[model samples]
Target: MADYPVTQGTHGPIYHICPGLRVNLNDDGNWELMLRTTDKRKRSSFGKGEEAFKKAIKAGELLALKLGLLQVEHDKERLLSEVAAEWLNLNRQRWSGTTHERYSQVVRDYINPKLGFLPLSRINRAKVREALTETAKIRAAKSVELVHATLSGIFNEAIDLGYTNENPSAGLLKKILPPKRKRNLTKPDPFSLKDRDLMLEAAYKHLPGSYPLILETIAFTGMRLGECLAMRREHLDLTNNQYFICESIRRDVIGSPKTGDRLIDLPEYLTKKLGAHITRMREEALAGAAFTDFLFPGIQQNAVRLMLKRACYAAKLRSRSPHDLRHTYASSLLMAHYSPVYVQKQLGHHSISMTCDVYGHWIPGEGKKNLDETLAGQPVSRRPALEVVDKKIPLVAASGTKSGTIY
Candidate 1:
């Protein structure tokens, strides 16, 4: 290695590893990392901090490659595309078909085209970041997230198999990607009470048999659309006005509901409505319509979504989706001062934090009502203290003096 020059600065020494490559320590007493390709034509970055030093090390390696100081790849390294495919195929049994398919699509469309050609050892955080940044430019935040996850998954597999030692895509989404504009945070997506009513009315008139009932069930209970579709007559308890929710439909497949199954409470009105609907289903079954054990036969998620849109249009209400009805149910509960725990149970959420994260904005950030007014509290009731008396006989006290009284 050639000897690199060093210089003293106002605060500390500047270590010049080579031309256009320096670790600077200045008045702030922190390391400043600056790196550029030879000839100083391509300056990559200038940053100050311990993290900058780490990034600089990686950047400097890249600069070294450009300067002909390092080889790009060795025979031992495998191309990232090949590694990714191997990683995905190996996990096929570990993931659901839909999950595996989604990840495969992400890798094919977003990840492989960009970083797949590089050797696994040569891939770094900057390359992953650039790919994700490019994805964000053209894709929605959600799609970007999927692309990021696919990359991270591949890199993780690489580490476990000893193909690479670092995970370049780790923490890249949260730390590097710009904050997504959360529409739910700005304004709750749940429909208004009037909007809900209008939509139900429109669905009843314009939609086919049991379509309105399906929407009503979602509106009254925070049941997911998938769960609603998967429901069977046995799942209902009309007497208790509760629905036993366990299974859900997804991607035209019956499966367990998200977060597992829990019974959902239904209002008495909805229970009666379900009772009549079931009777109607029985009547249709006798008349020759195909007998479907499901509560809403032939209605799927996409169909429910379309139903909501049509209802919204007919009612002249703001458009929404089936899942948005779930949101509406939660918002109604929050507005009624239902505790987070209750809402969490009703929605079958995994955690209280998740419940709050999605619907916290609907809740009052500050105390909105005085305790007296809200609770109808008054001075606590009290009973009178019991009276006590004591008597003592003095008959023999000082016997001579008490003789007359004693007798």
Candidate 2:
């Protein structure tokens, strides 16, 4: 062992124990080992003898190198909330405003409250599942699912940044959480064809101005209220008899459409009506009306919904939501034997399964009729009835008198 110079300090003696390593005796006479390697510096105590202390320092350096902690100069004990904030800031811009707001709110309301203080490395699957289970008590299963997804996204970002090795929230939902209850598909209560006609007629009669046209457009095109409200002049092409759906409005903020852009073919009658509507809008614009770009002009979704409700009442029809008009459109298509794929594309659903899952019951097909026909060809058989009467038969006797009689 090389004899190194020991520098005396106020507490005790400090020795240059090795290259990149030091040993210091504290006021309490305990020995501490300090290690400095590349970009990292860490210190710990090694109890007693000089020989034992040197061995401890060597072992510590080897462990730190193996963990890759020797080259990384970061707080290895950073909390989950710190990493989450970084992740949200980096990724929120890619999402729509509503989606960003929703993620932020979920993180604030559910996740951060439960697991924020835990160190990133310590946030394991069990901790994540426990938090979700607790959240499920007061929030709906859907809300819990959102929380789980958000947490998983955060951990994934942490992994990319080398803050953690694994996403604790991965597969946690399936392992510990019960499946979310299926939505009650019957609740939407889509308007039937008769009800639709009656409501449109009632709207034309009872509602003022363009309210009826708005309802008609939604029913005919199956456009969502936001998309309908957000429509503009450039979106329509009368020559091609098509309308482009590239954007939607929510809370008066225009954004990309939910399922991206699509071109919808319009019926001739609708094309003509829309052309007249556009002409009227142009005239209004020239006459110093509000200089808004929206095709519907100055109408909001809530006002439209209120007018729809009154129209349904006046028409003696069951009350229907504005969304029901969209449902009515899809239902009519399916009832006419339109292919589910066609319906899915027309509705701009991201997947055909979603279209089928929601509207499968309305799609026309053989249904139970086929089963009925299969059973209809079978023959029926009947068995004879039994007859009963009071009767007695006896045989007789050792005397050979064959004397028993039945009557």
Candidate 3:
């Protein structure tokens, strides 16, 4: 046994066991590392041994450096929830309102419940994997992915702030989480042109005031339901037979359009109809009707959905969602021999591959019909260019008689 420099503590005398480290043996006979920096002290037990004391000193110094305690006092034992809140505050301005809200929900529902209490330093890859495994049990794979992403974002921000060394959620997803299954490649079931026409006609006959026109606009221009409901008179360009899709409304919060701004061309008939609807809206507004900037004035997404549901029922048609109207528009354009690039722009898809991925099968030459047509044309000759003939040749037998053989 060697004498070590010792300091007095409330429990007993603590040993100055290593450089920038101290140790105290507790009543339970456990050797605890008493970490002393310039501004604060922390205690951690790594069991009773000279070896354990040395290892604890090394680990504590590394953590202290990571927490910036070497240069200044820092809250090294921050909970995951605290880091998440800081992350949200720093990034709230960068993300759209919907995106921020979605991320907030994921943190509150998934990450906070499982890992919020854990200290930032204690949250390693295994801890994150456990959280993800638990989340996967009850949530969809996509939800689990979001949870993973939220945690990664928080830890990454923590890393940049020197609060932690690594993002535990990084790369663990592919290893521990189940691979996301491929989405079905089948073309979305949208209303046929005839069915769309029938639905529109029935809507006009059954629905009250401007609802049919709203449905018609969605079908004519591949506008999302939110974008349609967010439209104001300023968005319409009747003379050009086009409208600008620049903003959207969700839960009464106005924000940028999902895929950014785009211009959508409308048919002359649709343009005329929209013009007439606007004229009537102005008259109604002047006549003391409820005024709103929305083209569909005072209608929200759910109201529009209900209107569409009733219209479909009245049309004696299969029930279709409001989104199905957008689908109908894209499918019809693709069926009319329109190029995927054109369709992508018209629908405001972020990428051509996205448009092709969803409606590629609807493209005339990209479906089963194309395969049938390709095989129906002809079979090219694949015969060999050379021919050989069989001839008889003389061969000697073991019995010394000549035998005839084919060569």
Candidate 4:
């Protein structure tokens, strides 16, 4: 028989019974911790002091259980890897394929290998911060945020399952800031009016068949490389003068749009170019040349990039990329005074914020025109007048030369 602690019940001093540091109530109950008062009768007479000791001991037992040194009624300590697996299992079906693949890789590559040694309850905010800060140095800001978010969710799940009472990552928001991401500052070589016309002329001169038409379609439509490459014969509708953007081909795998939307329209010039390319393909097939259903098949994506690079070189222009064609398209549309919301839909952006974030800078260089148009759409009180004053008055004579007189 172990010493029982003198704890006060409602009436008076009650000699409470407990054994060792942890007492198992029979074979089935929450383990009760034991602590004896130094002077049982005296502490009991001093009022609720004995009861306070029992409460403190009970709380201590719960803390011990949470820290994984002791087991609770039914809950067991969980390994970090086990928790991560559970997290993935719960979220796998809810996330998109692209999203699920990325989260899985992050957990496997970063979180598990580094933190797997610790039990879920033992992991603390300091450990989580160290992992995230180190990852920021190696990966992009967006990736760091994603990994942090995933880990946070996992820990939250552990809390819900009673593996731990509190999430280690709960206080992380105040402790960590996402690293500032460096924008891709190098601008793509934008095509001038003359440069674009020259490239069109060269394509017509050198690749008179389908290739020229394909180039024209890409230049005018601003379709993504994968989207343009994925175009099939069945997707075209010359009578409607519209080419639908329904799918994309990535690494030769055909799939629906990343934006999850099925359709966008191509401009009439792009439609005509598609028609011409198709006509050329038919002519080439008749002349002992094989063609594919894919409008731009058989050409590797790298080859497309390389070909575009060479064209830029030939034009004596700075190196450009296939993606620049996309910028060119968006810049042109925005310059034409088309609505950003409309452009967002065409580009399949989930939010107008993304459209503005990526392409908003392009509008500022449009020489105050966009600002004026935007301001016009506002309520009368909000709209400000465009003020213009001549900063300098040139001294010109009748002969159209500078006057001899000076102030």
Model number with the top lDDT: 3
- What is the C-alpha RMSD, rounded to one decimal, of candidate 4? 17.0
Q: Which candidate ranks first by TM-score, i.e. highest?
A: 3
lDDT of each: 0.76, 0.77, 0.78, 0.65
- In candidate 1, how many Å is residue 213 off? 2.2
- Candidate rank order under TM-score: 3, 1, 2, 4
**Compared with the true structure, what per-residue lDDT tens digits does model 3 show for residues 266-362?**
8999899888888887898899987666787567788888988898898889888888888888888888778889999999998999988787776
lDDT (Cα) of model 1:
0.76
> What's the TM-score of every candidate structure?
0.63, 0.59, 0.64, 0.54
**Residue 17, model 1, lDDT:** 52
Count of backbone collisions within predicted model 3: 0
**Reference-based TM-score, model 1:** 0.63
Question: Which of 2 and 4 is ahead in TM-score?
Answer: 2
**Model 3: how far is 373 from its true place, Å?**
10
RMSDs, each prediction?
A: 13.1, 14.4, 11.5, 17.0
| Superposed model 3: Cα runs more than 4 Å off | 1-76, 117-127, 130-140, 175-187, 201-211, 306-319, 364-407
Worst 10 residues of 2 by lDDT: 376-385
Error of 4 at 153 (Å): 2.9
lDDT of 2 by residue, 121-201 (tens): 656777788789888777766777789899989998989998778888888887655555552223557898888999999
Q: Quote the RMSD, in angstroms, for model 3.
A: 11.5
Name the weakest run of 10 consecutive residues (lDDT summed) in model 3.
178-187
> How many collisions per candidate?
0, 0, 0, 0
How many pairs in model 1 have backbone atoms within 3 A of each other, for residues 3 or more apart or on separate chains, i.e. clashes? 0
